[model samples]
Target chain A: MGNQKLYKGSLQTIILKLLAQNDKMYGYEITQHVKELTKGELKITEGALYPALHKLEAEGLLDVEVAKVGNRLRKYYKLTENGTKETANKLAEMQEFLKTMQHLVNPKFSLE
Target chain B: MELTKEQVLQIDNYISACGIKYYDVKMEIVDHFASILELRLEEEPDLDFKKAIVEEHKKFSNNGFKKLLEIKTDSVHKRFFKSSLKHLFSFFTLPKVIITIAIFLGLQFIMNSISDTEIFFNILQGFALLLSFRLLFNVNMRNNNKISFLSLSITLRFFNVFHLFTILFQFLDNINGEGFNNIHLLAYMVLFLFYWSGEYVYYQNKKEVQEQYPNVIV
Candidate 1:
């Protein structure tokens, strides 16, 4: 919870995984969803979330859809086909990193 | 708690006053602010609308909105460049390659047939005039309507500037009767094709934006 810096590198992977599971999400929806799922242990700030989204979008990993809801236009971010494919790779990379970190922290743990 | 019309307008004004000029970026930011404000109000019913907005705005501390605008602008420029590069490379693809070859040969033939360099310069001048007028007209239209410039508009303007530079080069290179050779003509045609491809891509982007926001006349 206090290690936001530790989570920084995994943010993109986390987002790709989330979008892989859910079809689409907006900025606030994403932050709130992450907070709810993590029981407030992790918080995705707007500053971090937006730049990540824009970077993914520019990289062609995500597509955007703007819809008029009530009186304002809401922009939704969904994974592109490329993004769907990338999600698997990113998740695998994160999984490997997590295993490495676990082994480093718990020295007595066996690789098997 | 849904935001009222006036409340939404207030949020929009706040975003604009923060220097986020692009309409697309503004819409996204306004929506984010609205969502956060609504959630805050729902959690604490006693919080006033303005107070909730201020609370939500505080979340984007350290001039986060400006950073967001910078990111949005960068993303737009990258998208435009990527799409234009895609179009530029498309000429080398299967069926399109044949068209490109034909256009090249046609330009070569025209250069060979026209002994008068004046006619060739006239043609170039005419095209330059037409494109300049088109660029001016579009810019004037957008300005008059207070429409925010999109990435496509920025790309088109960049091309217009490049095109003007090319015209200047041509003017400077003008010699008495030593007209353009076949190689020069081919290069000119390639440049023309590049400009046309960019224009076509901009047109496609404009069409998509118009469809996306049918309520707004883009």
Candidate 2:
């Protein structure tokens, strides 16, 4: 479980990773998915989720599709081709950060 | 726990009252509210719908929906600028670059060959005015049809139309009675190409939106 400060920086990476797995997701689905995955440890507030989504879309890393779902229009986001490549890069970066954190926190851990 | 039609309308009213005016933004927020409300009702059957709505909305932080609107608008502007730049640069790419050069050379030749510079300028001015009016007419038609959701691309097209008009007036004022030198010819050629590129981008964007949202009466 990560704190808000840690989670804030990786929110975009987490979203890109999730969208890489899922074909498409709407706003609420994303929040609930994160909460469920973390077993209630991580709660993605709507305030954070939407702005991140919008930013990704703006950056051409995500594409938007609006569908009429049960009377209301739901905006579903999926990764673009560039986003797919970006997901791999972001995941690698996150892995490196985690390894560094482990080396710092656990003195016995070796880089090898 | 499916939401009733009345409940959906209430959610729409809530979003509208919260100042989420853009149709696209409103739709997204309404959908978010709907899902949250349904989950709330499912968890606590006795919770009142209105109360649940308020509770769910409170999760949007202290600024409520205002922050969402700002973020959405900012995102749209960024996307619009990026897409426009891409389109503008496409003229310098392979295949398109050939056509761009051809147009440039063709315009330069015509401008140099024409002895009556005023006639050529008048023709250019007329074309600019015609394009401005056509864009204004298209925007008005969309507005009258109640399709007021000006997406980023559409908004850019509107801006370009007005911008072309301003450039036309400026060109007329600045170039009047001045001999058409090589630099002036090159500038006019660039302006013409830019205007064409803008129209091409606008047409492509409009076609895309029309295809994406077939139900949108645009």
How many residue pairs clash per model? 0, 0
* Model 2 TM: 0.79
Q: C-alpha displacement of A1 in model 1, angstroms?
A: 3.7
Instruction: Show model 2 residue runs off by greater than 4 Å.
Output: A109-112, B43-51, B88-120, B153-158, B161-192
Per-model TM-score versus the true fold: 0.84, 0.79
RMSD of every candidate to native, in Å, equals: 3.3, 3.9
Deviating ranges (above 4 Å) for candidate 1: A110-112, B43-48, B89-116, B139-146, B173-188, B211-215
Fnat across every predicted model, in order: 0.67, 0.69
Q: Whole-model lDDT for model 1 versus the true structure? A: 0.77
Q: Give the Å error, residue A67, model 1.
A: 1.6
Docking class of 1: medium
Evaluating just chain A, the predictions reach TM-scores of 0.95, 0.94
Instruction: Itemize residue pairs with steric clashes in candidate 2.
Output: none
Q: B24 in model 1: Cα distance from truth in Å? A: 2.3
Count of backbone collisions in candidate 1: 0
- Displacement of residue A103 (Cα, Å) in model 2 is 2.8
Interface C-alpha RMSD, model 1: 1.2
lDDT of 1 by residue, A35-94 (tens): 999999999988888989999999999998888888888889999999999999998887
Taken over the whole model, the C-alpha lDDT of each candidate is: 0.77, 0.77
